[model samples]
Target: MNGVSKVSPGVGTGLSKPVAAALSIVDCDFHPFVPLQEVIARMPARARRSVQVSSYAAVLGREHNRFLIPTGEPLRLDAVPTRGGLAGSDPAFAVADYLDRWGIAAAVMMPIQAMGVIAWAAEEVVNSYLAAMNDLFLEMWHAEDPRFKMLISVSPHDPDAAVREIERLADKPGVVGFQIPMGEIGLGSSAMFKVYAAAAHFGLPLVLHPNSVDCSLQNSPSCAGRVTRSYAEHHVLLSQPGQGAATQLVMSGALERFPTMRVVLAEFGFSWVGPMMWRMDTAWQRGGGADGLLPRPPSEYLLNQLRFTTQPYDEPGNPRDLVPILDSMQAHRTLVFSSDYPHWDTDRPDVVLRRLPVELRERVAKQTAMETFGTRLGL
Candidate 1:
């Protein structure tokens, strides 16, 4: 709040130019950051001292994005106002820059720090800091506009705490989903079932935004033992964890246990869904679909339970080629639009997949998102 000035209409006047040709849109993976300072400010005194006087929550400020060329944090520099402030640190600017400019009907808040906090903090520290950030999100952004729905971030480190967080804020008009931090943990592991159950109980989806965290799960962030050299390689392989998580969740019996559970693979490209689903379906059938577990093939569980964001939608040499890819994933049923706004590589809704058939395009641009998050517009 100290450095983030409210946008003066004339200065930061007018909303951003619309990306896609559409007027009404629902952006699923928007990042709303509470400055690290603000998060520290909200912490209980001991935590506050821990953050300021010592190296507490240091990972939040780490250079996790620079495994490639020295390009800094993924945020767009322009997003940091000419007036001086951290990029994405101001909600008023986001209104002027993303929502108002594009005539966006609704945008989900996936706070970056909210996810990062869980990756490194101790369970107790994670709980207090997360709760504070949730409250901060309500006061700073969600309370400002109903269209900016909040996704409360929960650490898998504490299942009971995660459930409590869900129950505590589920009834809020702006709270719509939960950010399930990407870690060594898989979606189906018994450790995560409680979090999943709690989310299903509230009808809120769990968002798994991939991170370069400590996970021995799949092909490590790098094929060998190192971080890849460029963002291009890392970006291309971003869907691995989503694929792995889906496999684990299905095999672990989490989906069969909580049938209504919904999962959103945030920023995880949609292109992989077709191949992954096919692979799982084939495996499930060969393995008898269930050794006393899953009643349906893995693909059925994935198709019905999971949704993917089209931020880095497949871009073949010809954009039209991406259509077949979307079709394979059942575009209308499984895809949702996510700009990943304010990031340096943020997608422009109008430009990303401007070549799809008119009807199919609209579903990706808005309708699917409406179905995914629509229940909250009135509340």
Candidate 2:
């Protein structure tokens, strides 16, 4: 327990049994929701007024087209809380439905409401929303259950403000990491180096949640530099931002600059990572665009400090073909299991664990997460 911190009982009698008694799996990408009104209540009067007049839809996006069919929320119909709200809005229900059932020892709660708003919203508005979100998650969600560790949300629009936010809540119980939506700004931008440096200093890993804005707005360019016409197109191209993030972090020397800071690209698939790394290394050797920026090979930095989640795990035409791709990507060492619980296309732990080759299951389920999150997981 030297570098690691354990979660102690909070107020009520905790879960009926120890969280570790189950599978010892760590879910790296679990979503927890706060109602729009709840978030508005926490915002400053001016910010609240802005959100109230504009409404959640208008404030978040005016023209963004989302195509969630049937249920309409990209959420599992069965995940609706017993208390009657959105699927992830109830902490106790999430625990019962996803965590306890799957034997997840720890679940990292990624905030959902204010995500991807940084690029479009004003600085003060985004700052107020994110700060309020961090407080709300800490008080309403994590405080209710020690098993719910959160990656506090912070807008990347203001690095000074972001650093201050980090300092304010760095020591709060149940805060395990930082979640930054990769807005129009690339992760390697020097503006983010302060946030990166602070994360390194705090020993908190940073998780980059892909920004949906890229697929919706013309100004916010998608990986292909054009607006996606449909949700299916958006879903198919989700890994582009993750790939861009990994490439920028390596080639721009961000990873080399903040060697201690670990980054996880959540909800983005990993089958393409091996090929991306190979391409980066080849470019590094041939003196590609990275030029004087990188001191070591790009792949080395990625393998050392970067991690990717295994949700929407790739399904090839031939089921047996997965093992080779998994081996090529060093899945046992670099991949972490993320159920993406309550989301429509969630992967069940039992199913994912079963799908993984026997030798790699333990690491994908738990060990790699422990390694990635380090002391934050209290493992």
**C-alpha local distance difference test of each model:** 0.71, 0.77
* Candidate 2: tens digits of C-alpha lDDT, residues 343-369: 888887777777889998889889988
Q: How close is candidate 2 to the true structure, as a TM-score?
A: 0.89
Clashes of each: 3, 0
Clashing pairs in 2: none
- Candidate 1, residue 267: how far the Cα is off, in Å: 0.9
Q: lDDT score of model 1? A: 0.71
Q: Candidate 1, residues 1-379: lDDT per residue as tens digits?
A: 7989866554245434465435577888888777667777777877665442222232353334335424755677667754566666677777777777776778888877765543344677777788888988888888777778888888657788889999998888788888867764666778888888888888887777765342212223433335655767667667776777777877777888988877788886888888787887776677743445777777777777788998876668877777778778787788888888887878877765565667676787777766665576442
